[model samples]
Every structure is written in structure tokens, then in C-alpha cells.
Target: MITEKAPGKLYIAGEYAVVENGFPAILVALNQFVYCSIEPSTNGTGKIVSHQYQNNAVQWHRQGDQMIVDQRDNPFSYILSAIQVTEEYARTLNKPLDVYDLHIDSELDSASGKKYGLGSSAAVTVATVKALCQFYHLPVNNDRIFKLAAIAHFAVQGNGSLGDVAASVYGGWIAYHSFDRQWLAEQRKFLDLTTLLNLPWPNLKIETLTAPANLALVIGWTGKPASTSQLVDKISLFKARQQAQYQEFLNASRQCIQRMINGFHAGSLEMIQTEIRYNRSLLQELARRSGVQIETPVLKQLCQIAEQFGGAAKTSGAGGGDCGIVAIDAQADLQSMINQWTAENIEHLPLAVHFMNNVHRYTIKLK
Candidate 1:
């Protein structure tokens, strides 16, 4: 059996503008990941099985030069895209695609809980590229992996920043700015910052080597599921009309993120607290100006409560409605806040700070 696991990412900065002008973005590969295992069949057909998600098996068959498919859930899209991309690349070197049965599972989605603004689809794409690399044994690196993932993401989700994509692939906190300069093909150049100010205390460790212990956080659920695709499209459509204002808000966001980073490093709770408010104010202003109302009153309430502790609070993912992440320091009123949230059916997730600068590749072989 052939098995492989690949990382997922969270965007620390450049959420919207990373696509605007290849602006800088920061992200980190999370401890959570997606894994795929494949086994070749003597028969000339393939099947995709899911161990974790509540989905049916996807079946496929080879017809002359094409691999025909029948899928139930959408997760299989990644595996197929990976196969097609790899197969196309291999063909340039006089190679044929690997014909095999595959299974995929991920830890990103809960059956129904804690939704963040990060795109789950993008994570699937990242995992797909990783699994495809293992299946084909391609000599692909982090940048190349993200380039391919961008293609897959484009195929389905249209255009996105690839901020989280870079982080998911690389791991750790990153300060990324996208520069659309191409070597062979156009790709993003991420000039990442290792030291970010606003990152939470206990930076969740995915590989055990990057344990930024001074961070702490809690997640608040708005009990609503929001899709990044639609929100992204709406923003793009409105970009022209709101270009000037958007740029200004983004500039403010960058400033807030930088200030947060400074506060995080200075070991000053006051600084951290102040920066969080600043960041939250900018986000609120963006939503108000755009008339997007991404932040609900309840969400704002959660942030206020989290702020009562040593950290600042804000929403996590896209804004229409989803979960939010709170950034806190070591010694605060965190436990009491958790107690109150527990009574409200809100759960506290282990906090994390984005901690990666590059997309990463891992390999394992089966005999």
C-alpha cells in the first residue's frame, strides 16, 4: 500500500490583497493534515474511498487515452486533478499516468463544528497535489507544488491568493507578499517575515519542531457556515468600484498585523491588547465601508469577551458568517472566559499562530 500525508494552512496576513497585486501574505502549515493511500488493482479500474467523511466511493475507468470518472462527494476532485496534472507533466517526458486505486481522508472538517474562513477546498487541492506527487514520485518542491495547486484551485474555485496554500505547504508563521514574477511560468515570490508581531502565544505545533510557546487562543462559533468562493467572487466584482477604499483598508490591515507582530515579540500584554483592537477596528471598518456586514453583533461580543483576557479577538475566516480566532497572551483571564463559553455551548480550541514561510514537500516509499 502507498500512503502519504500533507499539511494544511491558515493565512496570517494578505487574505484579500494577496491576489490583488501579488501582495505579501503570511501563513502556516497546521498540525492538521490530509492523508491519501493508494493500492493498484489488477483490474483496469480505480476506486476512491473515504475513511473519515460521510461520502460514497468514487469509481473510475480508463477508456483508451482518457480516465472516465463517476464521483459522489467533491473531495475526489483533488486526487483526480493531481493525477491529471502529474500525468500531463509526465507525458512531456514520454510517460503514462499511474493507474491505481486511491483513498483520501482529512482532519480539517468536523462533521459539523468550528468553521473558519480559510477555504477547505484549497486545503483539498493542497492535499491532492501532495498525494499526486507521491503517486507519481515526481521531483516537485514547495513552489512547484503551490504552482500546481494554484492551477487546480483555479480550475474549481477560480482565483484566490494562495496565501494559505503557501503556508499549508510550508508550515509555521509567514509574512508573504506575492510578486508575480515568472521563471518558466508565472509564479508567486513570497518574501516571508519570520518575526510577526500579532501572532498568538502557543503556536500550534504540526511537526513538533515549531512550538512557539508564548501563544494562546480560543475559537468562537457563530453557528453559520459560509463559503469563501461566493464571498471572494462578490469582492472581486466590487473591487473596481471600491478599489481606492479597499487599498486603504488593506493598508490598515497590514499595519495592524505588523503592530500585532511587534506586540507579540515585545512581551507586552498592553501592546498586544492595543494591536488587537486596532486590527479589529480596521476589519470592522472594511466591512462597514464595503457594506458586507461580515461581522455580526454576536461575533463582536465574542471578541469583547476574549479581549477581557490578555489577548485580542477577531473573526477567523471569510466574514459573511463563520468562526473567529482570539489572540491572547500567557497570563490572562482565559480560564474564566472558557468557563462562560462552555456554558454557552462554545468550545475553546487550542490556539495557533501561523508559523511557515514556504510550501513544503514530504516523501515516503512502500516496498
Candidate 2:
């Protein structure tokens, strides 16, 4: 059996604007993960199993090197996309494919099956692709895994910045600039998977970031799940209706992320915190203009309490509701903040940054 895992992620800055090509976002991988394990099957049939779904398992079969499933929806969509793309790449390598039972388990959600806004879908896609690559004994690195996973994710979702996918594959604090999806779509019309993976995608960048020694990260859950895609779609419509304001938001977000990146490099926690606060304000403005609630009342309260405790806080993702992140001094009154969040019915997630050693690093360049 081959097992692989990818960590869940939170957007530290640059949410709505990062969807545009070349826009930068900062995200951190959390210790929570989705694990995928593949085992060779002798019964000439394959199964995909996940306890999170309604049915515990879905059976699959290989028909002339193609894995076919009866139901392709929701959670299965990402898994199936990963399997198909990975198998296609393996065929490009002239590698033989075999029947295997794939199992998935996730800690990215709550015990009650509520999402924590930790990018579970992206984590599962990355984990599935990595597990299959390992099973086929394909020589792959972080970049390869990331590319394959991103392709699979885009095939299903068809939108978003893909920063979560990068965070999952790289497993650390990263500054990610999205690639040109239109370019990718056009290339996919004729290019093979292996060829596509080898190309230096336009505007795509992923760079590791370091936090100051005195900085501490905190996460609080609003216990309300938000559909990121729905909020993004609303914002897209707003962009069409209000082009000038949208561009201004994008430019402001780009500048804010660049400053935050500089703070990381200079080991300046104050600078990072200031930028975090600025980013939050940018998102709030976007939400107001777009008529999308990027931050809910609960998230607002969460941030206010953090500020009262001398921390910088903001809604993590597309954020109608989900989780809010805070960056604070390591010696701040974290316990008091947590107690206040508890009083406000917010759940404090005790998560640490997840990191992987010897991963490939990209240079930081903001466009």
C-alpha cells in the first residue's frame, strides 16, 4: 500500500483579487490533512472509499486503461479527476496501470462533518495524485505533484486562484501568484499531460515564506460554512458590472501582498500585521461594492476580539462564514483572546503550520 497526505490551507491575504491572472496571495498549510492510500487489488475490481461521503465506497473498473465510475459528483468528482489525470500521465511515461483500491480520510473537517474552510477539496486532490504517482513509482517532485494536482482541480472547479493547491503540495507558508488559466485551456487542446506539466506556466509563481520568531498564528471558526465558488461567482458578476472599482481592488490587493512578502523577508512582524489589517479592509471594501459578504457578523466579532488583544485578524477565504485568521505577538494574551472567542461562540482551532523538508522553492515576484 502507498499512502500520501496533503495539508489543508488558510488564505492569509489576497482572496478575491488572486483569482485574476498574476495576482498574488499568501496562504499557510495547516497540520490538518487529507490522507490517500492505494493498495493493489487482486479481485480485478477497484474501489474508492471515503467515510465523509453518504455512501462509504464507490466501485470502479478499468475498461481499456480507463477507470470508469457510475457516480461522478461532489467529492467523487475531485477524486476521479485526479485518478484520470494521473493515469493519463502514467500512460505518457509508458508505465503500466493496475487495479487498486484507493481510500481517503480527512481531518480537515469537524467531527460533525462541518467544514472548517481548510481547503479539503484541494488537499484531497493533491493527496490522491501523490499517492498514485508513488504507486506507479513515477519519479516526481513537489512541482510535478503540484502541477498535476492543479490540473485535476481546475478540470473540476474551473475557477479560483489555486493557492490552496499550492499550499497543499508545498506544505508551508507560501506566496502564490496564479497562472493564466486561459493559456492553460488553449494549450490543453493539443498538448499532452507530460508536455503541459513541463512548461513554465505564465504568471505562475510559488515561493516559501518565513514568519518572524515573535509571531504567532491563530485560527477561529465561525461554525458556518460558506460556498467559496458561489461568493466568487457573485464577485465576478460585480466585476462585470463595475469594472473600474474591481480593477482598483485588484491593484490594492496586489500591493498589499507585496508588502506582506517584504515583511516576511525582513523578519518584520509589525509590517506583516499591518498588511494583514490592510488586506482585511480591502476585502471588506470589495464585499461592500460587490454585495458579497466576505466577512460575516461573527467573523467581524472574531476580528474585533483579536484586535482588542493586539493581534491582526481577517476572514481567511471567500468568507461568508468559516474561519478567521490572526497574526499576533508570541507573547500576547492569547488565552484571553481565546476565552473571548469562546464567549462569542467561535471555536479556536489549535493548528500549527505544516512544513515539508527539501521541497523546491520558487523566487518571489509580484506582478
Cα deviation in Å at residue 313, candidate 1?
Answer: 0.9
TM-score of 2: 0.94
Instruction: Give candidate 1 misplaced runs (Cα > 4 Å).
Output: 51-74, 113-118, 179-213, 258-273, 351-367
lDDT of 1: 0.57
Ten-residue region with minimum lDDT total, candidate 1? 192-201
Local distance difference test scores for all models = 0.57, 0.91
> Per-residue alpha-carbon lDDT of model 1 for 214-244, expressed as tens digits?
5564566666666665667666666779888
lDDT of 2 at 209: 88
Candidate 2: regions farther than 4 A off: 55-73, 360-367
Could you give candidate 2's per-residue lDDT for residues 94-170 as a string of tens digits?
99999999999999888888789999889999999999999998878888898899889888877898899999988
Worst 10 residues of 2 by lDDT: 358-367
